[model samples]
Structure formats: C-alpha cells, structure tokens
Target: MAKIYLDPGHGGTDPGAVANGLQEKVLTLKIALKTRDILNRDYEGHSIRMSRTSDTTRSLSQRTNDANSWGADYFVSIHINAGGGTGYEDYIYNGSVSNNTITYRDKLHAEVMKQVDFRNRGKKRANFHVLRQSSMPAVLTENGFIDTTADANKLKSDAYLDRIALGHANGIAQALGLKRKSGSGGSGKQGYVEVITPSLWTYNTANWDDKAVIVNEGEVFTVARDKFKVGNGHMYQLKSGLYITASTQYVRYYTK
Candidate 1:
C-alpha cells in the first residue's frame, strides 16, 4: 500500500496567509481534509495520514519528521499564496525536477487546474522546507493567492474548495494508479456506471422478487457475476452481492 501524508500548512497562531474573509490555515485544512476523505471513500490500497486534523499548530520540522517516521510514499503540503496574484500553482524540490515528484505534480496540477477558475500559474520548483527535508517525494501546493480579490472570492465558496480537493485527490489517484474502492453501499468497489435515473430497485432474486432495496440516484455500484432479464429490463449482481437494475433508465453502464 502506498502511503501519503497531507500537511495543511500553518495552523494555531501562525495564520500563514490571509485575505478577504478566508485564512490560509483554514482553507488549507479544509482542502486537505477533503482530499483525505475522497481518497479513503473512493479508492483502495492507500494508507493516508494528515499532519494536522484541526487548527493545531505544527512546525515544518515536526511535520516532515512525522511523515519521515511513517515512511510516507508522498508528502503534499497545502497552502494559499500571498502577494496579490490569483490562480493555482504547485511545486517540488528544485534539484529533483526530473524525478517522479514532477510526474505526480503534473497530474495533480492538471486535474486541479481544469476544475477551478483561478489563473494557471503553471508547475514550479523551489527549495521549500518540506520539499527539501522530506526523504520521500514531496510537493507544496500554493492553491491560490489569498490576497487577490478574485481568488479570495473563489475561496469563499464551498464548491471552489471542493474543486481544489478533487483535483488533488485525482492527482494522487493517478500518480499511484489507485483503483476505485466502492459504490454508495460501501461495498469496496465503485459502480460501473452512475445511477442516472431517479432510482433503481435491488432484487431479492435475479428473477425480480417482491421486496427489495431501493438504490437511489447518484449511487454507483459494481456489476455482479449474475444477470437475468426481467420483463423489459435486466438485472445484475451488485458488489454487495445483491441484485440490481442494469436497465438504461436506472443506470448508465455496461458490465464487463
């Protein structure tokens, strides 16, 4: 299992950067937490840890040390930049430019960039403390310039923060080749296709039984080993070992 350490830059007394109504510490923590949650909920085969789960202060040395001790495969430090610019940018240790860190950074940067309105500042390099000190591959991301008016307004929205978190989570998954772990039922695997219709019914039998569970809209699940045609519709096994609809009106996917 690959290990990833998320360090939400600055906390407690050290606010890091600030502007408008958003503080860098708070923003970073929010994004970092989201990233972790996404990785845990949607993917498998990862050991994820965080430097700080709350507003507790932590030093750079302490953060790196904790990750190092844990033998993390990757370290991601989340922060918001200052100095009146607007947009997103990411970094790796300067001297290790051509290494895997860049590959991971590039994937993450692209995922995040496509989802946000911030100006693309491009991937960069630096001698940041966490990058230079961490034994494993490390990156520090300046999500956006908190001091910029446009960027600050973007940060103020819950949706914007979700985009940032999604970008980072996708990057991590791409870098590690992590597989989808589950559907809405927490069955340890995601659905082959999303539930597009209002809802679909689970069957007690492949032939369509009298009573069954209701899988609602937006839920995903893996196709099962068994399938059968029931009237004008079809059914397949859910990852949960139950039967569900395989009809176009209920779900938008094909079983392998």
Candidate 2:
C-alpha cells in the first residue's frame, strides 16, 4: 500500500496568506480533507495521512518529521499564494531528486491544470523545506493567488475547492497506479466537458433558466453523455445531474 502524507501549510496563528477575507490555513485544510476523502472513497490500496487536519500550529520540520517517521511513500504540501500574482504553480526540490519524483510532479501538474480553472504558472523548482526535508518524493502546490480578486473568488467556492481536491487526488492515483474501487466510475475514458467561457452556469434540469452552479473557465467535469437538445442548441448533462450548455462557444466536450 502507498502511504501518502498531505501537509496543509500554515495553521493557527500563522495563517500563510490572508487576503480577500480568506485564510490560507482553512482553504488548505479543506482541499486536503476533500482529497483524502476522494482517494479513500474511489481508490484502493493507499493509506492517507495529514499533518494537521484542524486549525493547529505545526513547524515545517515537525511536519516533515512526522511523514518521515510514518514512512510515507509520497508527500504533498498544499498552500495558497499571495504577493499580487495569479494562477497555479507547483514546486519540487531544486536539488537532485529521484526520477520517480520528477515523474510524479509532471503527473500532478497536468492533472491539476486539467481540473482547475487557473492559469498555468508552469512546474517549478524551489528550496522549500517541505521538499528538501521530506524523505519521499514531495511536491508543494501553490493553488492560486489569495491576493488576487478573481482567484480568491474561486477559492471561496466549495465546488471549486472540490475540483482542486479532485485534481490532486487524480494525480496521486495516477502516480501510484492506484486501482479504482470496483464501479467507482471515475475512469476518465467517459465523456467530459471543459469550460471555455469565463463562466458557465449549470442547471438542475434541462431548462436553461434553471441555474444550479457556476463552473469557471478551464474547469473540466465528466458528462453523462455526448450531448442532448435543451433549447435552440444543445446541453451536456454532468455526472452530478447538472446540465450545461454544449455550445462550442461555452464548452468543448471530449472523451478521455
């Protein structure tokens, strides 16, 4: 079994980044918890652990020590960015690491970019403590800029956070070759939708006016089928039972 260790950066008094009325600690924990839940519910043969599940203080060394003691196979540190920039970027240690670590990083970056509505800041390298000190392959992802209004708004959405979690979980499962629980139905080969507009409204029913949620641009979701008529054009039904416009102007459907 692969032992995965998740570290939610900054907690308690040390909120990593605070902007747009949001705390980095809270968002990181939310993503980590959701990621763990998704992995446990849909995948098998992997054991997951977190540095801090609640709002508690933890030093960088302490967190790494815990994972090292536990003999974690992989380490993923989740954090938010500040300093007036937007988009997603992840870091591996600048120093030499195993080829497995680089491969894992590539898979993670691709999966997260596929699922989240964020600009690609490119896969990067850094001398971050989490990466340098961890005994196993480690990746630290800065999801989005908390100081930027556009990115912060997405961070505030539970559904958006879930997408982030899904992306992270997807990467881990792929890197470890974790098997899908029988009938988990997340096997990407199914039809899916990728938002192309600034925002696409989903409806609980086929009616265009029956709005349910807003899926931001670049976000991807699995669809029930190819497409079906809704009004003047076509709509794609999400596996979540929500309907979205299948117009090429708003979304592009694909099967992986």
Candidate achieving the largest TM-score? 2
Q: Please give the RMSD of candidate 2 to the true structure.
A: 7.8
Runs in model 1 with CA error above 4 Å?
A: 184-256
Number of the predicted model whose lDDT against the real structure is largest = 2
Instruction: Please give me the total number of clashing residue pairs in predicted model 2.
Output: 0
- lDDT, residue 113, candidate 2: 71
What is candidate 1's lDDT per residue for 3-37, written digit by digit as tens?
A: 99999999999998877878999999999998998
Candidate 2 lDDT tens digits, 118-200: 77899999999999999999999999999999899889877678778888999999999999988676533477789988987
TM-score of 1: 0.71
TM-score of every candidate relative to the true structure: 0.71, 0.78
lDDT of each candidate versus the true structure: 0.79, 0.88
TM-score of 2: 0.78
Report the error of model 2 at residue 39, Å. 0.3
Which portions of model 2 show Cα errors greater than 4 Å?
Answer: 187-256
* Model 1 poorest ten-residue lDDT run: 182-191
